[model samples]
Target: MLASPLIEFIAREHPAFVHVPLGLVAALPLAILISFLTKHARPLTGTAFFIAAVGWASSVASLVSGLLWGRQVNLIPVTGYFPVVASEKQVLQKMLQLHITASLVGFVIGGLCTWLLWRAWRREDSPGFAERRHAGRRFWERGAGVPALVVALLWLGSWGFSGKLGGIMVFGNEETNKAAADADRAKRNDAEADLPIRALDYASLEPAGAAPERSKAHGDRWRRIWVTASGIDDYQAGKPMKPGAYAVMATFTDEKGKPGTEPGPLYMKETKADGSTAFLFYWARVPENLRKEVGGQDSVYWRSPDPKLITCLGCHEKDATPAK
Candidate 1:
């Protein structure tokens, strides 16, 4: 889901907002340790409670903003709690999964620690608290103080680890940088990359018709034709596309005898300098029910000279055709 501008701004500020809770939580262990040694334990215990409560509360904002930021970056799926780490090569995704897990664990631990402190604070402030014989004992040995301290330490450790992972993600590590560069090089070497790009952005060309029309030769799908400036007049006149010009046909699956909301494959034909035609068929996302049409693949990209495009060449033997 797309977030509002205000929410997007908050998500972008996640790095800044996280420091508030982290700083508070980092100081919590010190305050609790001091409370154990102080003669005036009640005041120090109250201060510890205040710090825990505020830190746990502020963590909510940090968690929410982090989730939003993760979605914005596509590291986490829109509806997923964790990113899919399918292989060892997915270094960044693996790090993100660990980071999210650590943050959640810390948040839960912090909540329990805060509650413990709150209970301890209430007992220390009770009217009969001074009269009790246990009141003379050290704060760590009394009530929930020691347990809260232990849990607080665990919380700190989890958040500290999570923060380390977050840092690596923001500032790429050796492994991450190398993986990114390799991926970029692979993409550049991929031959279908530019063809898929042009097919996806076919709308930038001039439209041959105001609305889509059903194409009987193209599986009865609704298709709208778009042509380059050099080929628009010729395409409208049923003449062959001139050299260096191309035409794209954007298709939609049928729905109740009309164009469905689901997008179908994009078909493109370009006339080369040698006067030969090149064809491209691209579908970024194929509907599940229609995956069989493309050999069960969820997406497809085929260009001229590939045996896969023989069907396209068979139909447009000479030039682009208007949808029937």
Candidate 2:
């Protein structure tokens, strides 16, 4: 059976709901701390309870929405499998764990604080309240003031960390994650840095009057586009293309030409490296995952370990020249 629209909607809208609880939880602790510093517990008791109550309630809603959303997206699969993007699974899983765990912790801490504040209010009305054994105060109650402060701090800290993790997952990878690809990128960057850097002159690729070639390809049907600039003369004449030569390949979708769904980051292929050709891409609009892969800086000229033909084989293989 198909999932409920409401659940899917919640999943799609989790970002919106998640923030409400984060804000409420953050404010609850601040209010409690201010009451302690001011020594004005009486006036702030009701306000603390009010904020805690709302924060707890919203946290419950946020947790429920997150679970339902997970189910909707198969993040927490109920039955059938839902495919995630190949490169994103690990980061997504980590964020999911953090979000759920922290929200539960927040709920528990908020509930306890609310109950203590209620008791504090009740004690204010007892006879000789200020000195009545500090009275009728249990051992735990005697030190409740400090513990309350500690719990509030934990609630704030956990919720904030969880929210930050969620933001990274939604926006892209975080800096500290240890993905294998990241290591590979570092190795590749070090290698590329040692090689000569050459800029391809776009207008010179094709003959002065020749128009650029264009075609549609890719499983998703992204358009296959290219212009042959300079440095391939030997390969064109049945010899190995010299190193440091250049060409440009651009992909576009039929619906929107020029800037396809994924556009720019023009790729420059050098003739040879490590017994195979090498490509360096200058990103116009960086891929979301790429930011994390490169340690937060969107540097130009990403080097791909995979060969150009294999990468573009889906459409360009048929037109490729045979190796000498």
Candidate 3:
């Protein structure tokens, strides 16, 4: 389902018109045939006319709706993924463009059909309207009916096929993609079980000058994440991680040129050997004064040990098993 209002409207309405063009195509022929059998069959001609008019109206509706719908769906998402099946995509695009051409063709055919039906009707009351009008009216009727029907069929068929291909994009990959995701996840799980979970040593920094070296190396990658920063956390990886939770905060330049900030914290309850959870907390933040603070402050801002805290599930929960 399209969340965007414009897309939603197009998606909803295209189907509505899909049937209209086809229905009118079906009704138009019946209308012309009945009119020829008896020019006085005003009811037949009127019904056909109504069908032709509505059919053409709906056909136009489908054409416009499809175009708008296509625009919204064809947008690039910015993620660096290549488009699959480029040629096929282009082919489908051409078909949609052709849908518009077909629509105009339908309009012309319907107009000419309606005009000929009227001409046939006018000959009805002219007592001898029959003899002189028969040949010309038959020709016009067949002429208008065949091509109009073809236009509707070809146009609607193309739109329908294009719609199916688009649908396959969002919802059709489920069977194959889901299976692949499941298989990859299973392999990862098997590997994590054999991997060693290393613990971070946050206690030592100044004596070894490891802090400055690490600080210079990573810069402000992790904001305000120093080992002795106000609120701190420690984790041991080889063993089940300590039951802990932490908030990762960072400063971002906002639209007004002033620094804006958002806090994203991850909470974790360590699992015991028996698989039970022990809840503990570790909150992280880069104080406003420490704007230039490097590796010891922000998550992703710095990358040294003292200023780093394992993110929930990101690092702490990564590599739980051995390699395949």
lDDT winner: 1
The reply for model 1, stretches above 4 Å from the true place, is: 1-3, 133-135, 142-144, 194-251, 255-324
Candidate 1 has an lDDT of 0.83
TM-score list, all predictions: 0.64, 0.46, 0.37
Reference-based lDDT, residue 114, model 1: 94
Q: How many angstroms is residue 158 displaced in model 3 relative to the true structure, after the best TM-score fit? A: 9.7
lDDT string for model 2 (114-183, tens) is: 7876676666555675564443555334322556667767878888877887777667664535554675
Computed on alpha carbons, the lDDT of every model, listed in order, comes to 0.83, 0.56, 0.42
Q: Give the C-alpha miss distance for residue 91 in model 1, angstroms.
A: 0.7
lDDT of 2 at 237: 65
Better of 1 and 2 by TM-score: 1
Cα distance off (Å), candidate 3, residue 19: 0.6
Q: Write the per-residue lDDT of candidate 3 for residues 1-324, one digit (tens) a residue.
A: 234786677755665556667666665665666654664555665566677667666666776665555544542111211222223323433444444445555566666665655554454545654445545664444323344344434544544454555454334466545545775776588532222121122332212122221112122222222222211323222233332322122223233433335432222233344543322222255444553332233432212121123332343444241111
- Ranking 1 against 3 by lDDT, winner: 1
Tens digits of lDDT, candidate 1, 1-324: 343899999889999898998999999999998876766667888899999899999989989998889877867655556887645777888999999999999999999999999888788768777556565776566644788889999999999999999989989999899989987897689765655776677889999899989988777899998999999998888888889888889999899998998888888899989898888888888877877676556777777654466677776776656444
